[model samples]
Target: MGDDVDRIKSRLDVVDIVGDYVKLTRSGRNYKGLCPFHEEKTPSFYVSQERQSWHCFGCGKGGDIFSFVMEKEGLSFPEALSLLARRAGIEIESYRRSDGSGKKTLFDIMEEACSLFRTCMNGDQGSVPRGYLDRRMIPPQVRSSFELGWSPPSWSFMVQYIKKKGISLKDAERCGLVLRGNRGPYDRFRGRVIFPIRDITGRLVAFGGRIVDGDGAKYLNSPETEIYSKRRTLYLIDKAKGAIRNGGHSIIVEGYMDALRLHMEGYPQTVATLGTALTEDQATILKRLADEVFICYDADQAGQTAAIRGMYVLQQAGLSVKVVALPEGKDPDDLLRSDGGKARFNDCLKEALPLVEHHIKLLSPAIKDDRTRKSAIHDLLEGLSNIDVTDVSPYLPSLAALLGIRDFEVLDALERVRSKRRKTDRSFDTEEIPSSLPDEGQQSQEMPPLPEIALISLLWSECDLRRKCDTREVVELLSDPRLKLMASSIMMGESPSSLEKRWLEMGETFQLRVLARGGAYLDEFTQNSDWKWRHFCHLLYRQKGQMRYNELRVKMLKGEATTREIREMEDLRQKLVSQKGS
Candidate 1:
């Protein structure tokens, strides 16, 4: 695999690969071009041909050819490797065989399942499902392009199919295609219209089955498995990502059908959540793909609530959010299907309200009703407090008008709401300590000091520091479990970019936060010798000791401290004091 990578790198020049995506001109030994990752007027993106690296000064993104492909294409490392290998005309069939994780096997199983479903959809068994699609106005090309399929109404059909294919029933079960019953393994998607679900990298991972005519749930999705996580997967993202990048925004809907309809109706940048609220993980995924998101959910109360919750989550992830107001009780599908619906939908997109304004619009009726006025005002203030102040500030006058309150009063109310929420979050019971030690959950909840984040970032950025630092010692000093895992991985020779990719795959955004917060201290840590790094480690140890000391002191105050705990508390206090003195 190493030799394969070297061969590919040796064949593909970074300048040539990047120039295909970015327009670059020779600037001395390097090429400069507008960054494809972020919006920049000047050409801050520089490609160094000599070093085979590229960096964007605007976004602080810098990496080699593989990293560039991964970022630009929103692909996983394996996908990027396959893409670049193919481009470089280097065969890596051996590399795929070397994967011991069984991911490749799972992927192959999913592909087989998809093929089986598609065959069933086109076969005689698919008559009812095909009729249902016709009624829904879905064209044959769209259905075929989306790989729509059908599962025959038979308990043993898929079981027999898998057996004949020589595929393990266990592998099928792992892919969420088969389930073990009291009798034997049965098909999970019997008598249903199947929607093949692919990951962002265009790999089939799971399926969503919609009952055409049956005594089962209206919709059923593949269960969480080794390769498929509903929160991390978006419907049609494989098809929509390119359009999302070109359009500079994304349109989010609530269901698979809605996404399909939007895509078929010339909205190629649309993706659907897996019939759930927009999770922070999903928001993080979008945050990487686009700067803004427009959510077009059903117009019912439940859908509006979902839209509001999703807007807050997306905003928290730093993406500008807008709510597409569909007509009452109409989803994107229904709205698009109505007379003159396409133009109306386009108008809705044009007139989508920003997050705060949309929240205000939702509360308008409640505020107008005298009986619900106070509650609506309170709700509005609480919701506003969750949003960034700058985002909410511009709408204060409008909100005040709706509430029939003074602008300053509205601002004061918002501040009070924010203060109350902060106090509630910080309110911890110190008197209820049973032991001097904090529980694992409590320890995990304790936010690590900013300096610790900076230290981890520095270690990740500088390979020499990773080699110098003891893995166990660094892991012990880290307070956050996530950081501990990251430190261990770094010490085990995982590259920072690889770790970042892993975190992104798992839908974790803490790495991004760590890098952003730790950027300020990177230069400081680099300029100072190893002493600064050692000092940060000492500070972490002292911070841990101080927390323990505080816990023990609380227990002592409550008269619950044992002799052992008392001795340990004293030792911690002394160590912390000595460290402080040093």
Candidate 2:
């Protein structure tokens, strides 16, 4: 643990971390800006003097730099640790080695498994899966670049081979490769073509195996173990992140084939869940890459359900989710298979419907009735209300038109819903409201405001800052957790003695993804100057029941707490205490 902390500290910077998701401005000893983790109209996100920490006045999600990556990116603790550790050029080998000295963690074993899978795919025997790829119509360049492979059907292929290669059965099991039963360990992915799934950092954390028999489940995916979760991964993120970032958009399709084929066919920015419905977590990942997401699903019922789910999640994350409705129940793969497949796919993409239109189409006739219709339309409006309306800027006129009203009306309705929503975000405590406050529990459960999601969307772009300002003093004064975690990772990393050394360690590709995401955001921040500091203070004060203070006595005793300073210190201190309690 000490080693991990040391490594993360040396590597991760609060500036780069906070900057990756929040636009910041240097003010005195810290950097200040809108809280990226929560919505606000003023700059509250701050990066500290030491550049080792950050805090926000609005959202309370704070922690060390590693926690920032872990939460915002949906990565596990060890994964975050390894990522930042690598960035710092600190490679961790186990204290216990061959002589019971050099040890490896769960992440190490997973990496080894991924490599072994890759080796098999590159070998002479790999021709089978390679042939399979060809049969599937994927280009060879894409095939090799993706390292697509097949796991030999034999139960002992990976198990026996890996053990022979010096891995302990325990390590293999921990990596989710071979499962140990009463008799012995059996390979998890037997008789299947294997596709290694890597996180954005390019680490091999999971696998997606397709049945070679062309039977049963067609595709058998890796189950969520300690290391892998379907909700948190996109099939081709490692390759597609750059494409998505540059395009300011992404193509989310159904199945591994669609992602692979699309990338192979010039659309390198495409990605997909592993043959499953899109999840909120997945949408979060996509949104982190680009401001817009174009979804292409099979035009079937299941596809619609998946599309709707994607729309809600992507929208909630502040991405403009446009639905590309394929004709005749065809998926991207199906289109690529048909005559003039690529053209048809491109046409559909060009004709993609904004989420509002898609929602209308999905719930149209069903919502034709007056009463039930309101509920249905309202359901979609609520979803729309969750979107970062800032993302809707380009499409606002169209969106407003589609909302069947003007932009202000849509904005007004969204504000009303959001206003009522703030009272219930559970993100804030309202114990002080007393009995006088109506328990609008029924109406308050709504999501946060969407209109201001532009600020929210900035979190995903923090890594993209174009110009760096000295924000040392401002980051110091903030008290929000989300800000702190993000700040630590972004700011601290930048202040380290050897920034390039640390970055070089993470590999060029990774360095680019982190920078690309944050870089774009940083650019936007410098341009907006649309700070959100005071708004954040408002949220913080409100969270504490807009307290009637013993401010006079405390400030007198403390001898120097400005109202802002006193309130902030109290808020942060309470948070630290509560965290310890929890």
Candidate 3:
């Protein structure tokens, strides 16, 4: 496995892989581009052809070719490896082996089941579903492209088929195509029109079955399995990602048919949420692909509520969100099927309201009524709290006007609500500590500091620094788990290339963060190892001092500070102050 990884690495240049996603230009010995992972205007993302790695300083994400593909394409390590291996023209036999866990086998089973379903749809057994599709005006080419299929109405149809094919019933069940019941294994999607669900990489993972004439629910999706997660999967994402990236936005609908209709109607940048509330994982996926999202769900109360909830989720993920308010009593599928519907739908897209304004428009009725005004304001405040204040500030006057309240009053109430939310998050009754501690600023606790990243990079790259520096205190000062592990490895004399290989196995986000944070300092450390070492040591000591100061402050707040501990706290505070001054 390692040999295959090394071969892939040796064959593929990180610059070429990343260049496909980001526009790069020469900057010194490296290439620089705007980060695709975040909203950055300045080019803070850099690629090192010499090192065969890339990192985004703005978003603090960096990694080699494998991690780059994994992060950019939203793929797992195995999937990314397979993708890059194919590109490198190297066949990995071990990757194809089904090690009894059936991870790869599950994908094969889904493909086989999809073939069976398509065969059934094209055969005489599919007459009913075919007629239904014909009535819905879904063209043959569209149906063929989406691989629309039918499951036979008999209970044992797929079970018998799987047995005849000599595929394990357990593996088919794992693919969510069969279920074990009182009468052994049976088909899970009998009498339904099958919509094969593929991941972003176009590999079939699950199915969405819509019933034409059945006693069961109108639509049934395959249950969550080892290979499929609905929260992380978006219908038509595999097809729409390119358009979304090209257009710099995505259009989200609620159902599979809606996405298909929109795609058929010349809007190829549309995807569906599989008729569920939008999830953070889905939002994050969209964030990676586009900067804006337009939600056009069904024009019903439930759909409206879902759009509003999804609006906040997308907004919190730092994507601009808009709501496409469809006409009442019509969904995208129904509306697009009508005469001149496409033109009207285009107009709706043109006039889509920003999420905040759309949210206010939705609450207009309650805002007008005396009975529900206060409750409506409270709900609006809650929604607004989920977004950044700058994004919501422009709408405050409109909101205040609707409530017959002054703008400052509205802002004051919002602040109070935000404060309450912060208090709830803390969930403790201690008094606030003074803000005289080390200025960590707005950095998240999960993000490794630049000094820690630099120190680790130095230790990994400079053998003399690794041999001379006292790494125990630096390792103890490190907070990020991956950084601490790498630092420990370097202290024990791990080679730079060996560490880079090990680093590739870590999570994409951690790799990006560490690499982006520390990659810039490699030259500086290499040039003046003695000066850089001392600088990083001081930063580590200051970090340690801040951590200790915070711990003592917490103890003091709880009235449990001992005399020696209090003295130590005072000493650490002075030391941190002196260090900051210096």
Which parts of model 1 are misplaced by more than 4 Å? 1-101, 423-582
Candidate no. 1 TM-score = 0.63
Tens digits of per-residue lDDT for model 3 on 145-221? Answer: 99999998889999999999989998888888899998788889989999998877566788999988859999999
Candidate 3: residue 467 Cα off by (Å): 42
lDDT of 3: 0.80
Q: Please, what is the TM-score per model?
A: 0.63, 0.57, 0.67
**Number of clashing pairs per prediction, in order:** 0, 67, 2
Q: Considering lDDT, where higher is better, how would the candidates rank from best to worst?
A: 3, 1, 2
Better of 1 and 2 by lDDT: 1
Q: Scored by CA lDDT, what does every candidate get?
A: 0.79, 0.64, 0.80
Error of 3 at 557 (Å): 22
Write the residue-wise lDDT of candidate 2 on 1-582 in tens digits.
Answer: 786788668765776555545545576566676666776655556678485777764476666687777777666666576666765667774333344311235567776676777677778867777777778877667666787776776777888877787878876776678888888888888767778887665666788888766456778777676667778778888778768767888988778888887876799998887766678877766665668989887788545854575567777766777888888767788788889988888888899998866775676555666666676656666766666544433444665655567754665576567556777876775533556643556223222322122322343244433134234433443344334343444555463225446656865333333333333334444344335433433444433432323333245344676767656655554453343344
Please report, as a residue range, the 10-residue window in candidate 1 with the lowest summed lDDT. Answer: 93-102
- Model 2 RMSD in Å is 15.8
